[model samples]
Target: MRKYIITGLLVWLPLAITIWVLLWVLGIIDGVFVWLLSAVQAVLPDSARASIRELHNIPGLGVLVLVAALMLTGMFVANMFGQWWFRQWDRLLFKIPIVKSIYSSVKQVSDTLFSSSGNAFREAVLVPYPHPQSWTIAFVTGKPAGEVGDQLATLSGAASEEHVSLYVPTTPNPTSGFFLMMPRSQLRPLAMSVDEALKYIISMGVVAPASDALSAHPAKQPAAAESARN
Candidate 1:
């Protein structure tokens, strides 16, 4: 009976969790849309409210609208006039005292992450952090070009005039992290794919690569060491 129950759990657990998560997300988005519609309905004509209600009743229309809005925004930013307008708008926002603080902060974050020329999360990398033997996942954002890299190289007495800025992201949540500027040679490349590395990190060392697993488990070590010696 216990064996049967365990097998059942293994089969059903993932599906159950996936369904619950999807339902929860849909519920939250639906709630937000309903609230916004209600707010607008107060000012809308009774005939218009009928159309709004009909639109809301169509499943997944809210998500479609959100996707369409994002696509439209991308299209707007692609053109010459939009680029000029964006700069002008940014200048105007900068002149406003209180708004400048908030606007600049948000703009910096968006530009760093989303701009085509900007170098955040450009290349995946591996970095040793906290300790020499210990390592963490990182991304190679951009090579330090212009005066910054040159000044650093001169100050450090480096033979090469190159430096790079790397963005190190924490697992389970990839949004927040520290940025480090280091010499290119110091960074090591990992054999595992990004998804595999993420799974290992998020599991907090419980999940390991096949090579690592062989080294860790006692039963496998003697054979592995013998093979290495040969």
Candidate 2:
């Protein structure tokens, strides 16, 4: 009976967690819609507020509204008129005091990570962190560019050696971690995708790539060692 119960739990645990998370997210979205309705109600006269308040009780309305809003916003922002308005709106936001500081920082990071032309988190690799003896999993965000790369090259003293930009995420909370740079020669690349690396990091090594998996650039290690010797 105990063995059967354990097996049943193993099957149901993931489903339970998945449902719980979805409900949590739905609650948050629904609350936001409720708050928006309350705000709208506050501005309108008492006689006009009932209709808006009535819609707030509808189930799944917030998710639909949020999805529609996102789609419409995306469609709107795809054109020249919207582009001009967006730039103006961006400028307006930057003019605000405390809001600008928070908004600008988040905007820059989001643009870097989500932009089509950017290479942030494109590849995963093992990085020698703190010491050469210890290594950590990291994402290859992008190399230092233009002036930063030039300065690093000048400071590194190894004129021929190249460097890579990496983001080493902490276990369980991958969002908060270190941004570091390492020599391209020392990096041991992985065949896993960025998503796989994130899962592994967040799981604190419990979740890992398949045993038979190969490195993305396994041959580069020997070549790099050869170049180091030369």
Candidate 3:
């Protein structure tokens, strides 16, 4: 009886969690629609407000509106005029001191993550962490550039070869973790895609990447002995 109950839980737990998360997100987005509806009600004639109230009761309407708004914004931003306007708007935002720092940092990260030409988090890799004989999954964010690259090279005692910047995201929350700089040669590059590696990390190794997907470059196996102790 216990075994059967455990098996059922194993099957349903993920589904339950997934549904809960979707509903949570939906509720947040729906709040925006609720605010907009309230504003419209304040401005509209009584008859029009009555019609709008009926539509407000429709479930998932906010999601559709939000998605449509995003799509429209994307389309609007794909042109030269939009590009110029965006630059102007960005400059305006940057003049606001406190907002400038927060917005710019977030914008840079978003651009790196979402830009078509960007290579951030494109490759997954394996590196030794904490101490030797232990390994962790990491994402190859990019090659360290300019002053950062030079400083890292000096610190690593290998100024000639390039160093890579990696992000080692924590399990379950994958949002917070360490950023590492290491030599390309010293790191073992993994064959797993960014998505696969993310699943592995978020699941805390419970969701392993495919066996054949575990290939490493330069060195066929991870070299825990040679891993940088930084």
Which has the greatest TM-score?
A: 3
The predicted structure with the larger TM-score, 1 or 3, is: 3
Name the Cα RMSD for model 1: 6.9
Which stretches of model 2 miss by more than 4 angstroms?
Answer: 45-48, 211-230
Quote the positional error of residue 51 for candidate 1 in Å. Answer: 3.0
Considering lDDT, which of the candidate structures 2 and 3 is the better prediction for this target?
Answer: 2
User: Candidate 3 regions off by >4 Å?
Assistant: 214-230
| Residue-level lDDT tens digits of model 2 in 144-192 | 8799788878875557778889998888998899988778888887777
| Top model number, lDDT | 2
Residue 81, candidate 1: how far off, in angstroms? 3.8
**In angstroms, how far off is 163's CA in candidate 3?**
0.4
Per-candidate local distance difference test: 0.74, 0.86, 0.84
Q: Write the per-residue lDDT of candidate 1 for residues 125-220, one digit (tens) a residue.
A: 667785679878777777776787767778655756466788777766766778888777777755454555666776765677666643444442
- Tell me each candidate's TM-score: 0.71, 0.86, 0.88
Tell me the TM-score of model 2. Answer: 0.86
lDDT of 2: 0.86
Steric clash pairs (candidate 2)? none
Q: How far in Å is the alpha carbon of 188 misplaced in model 3? A: 0.7
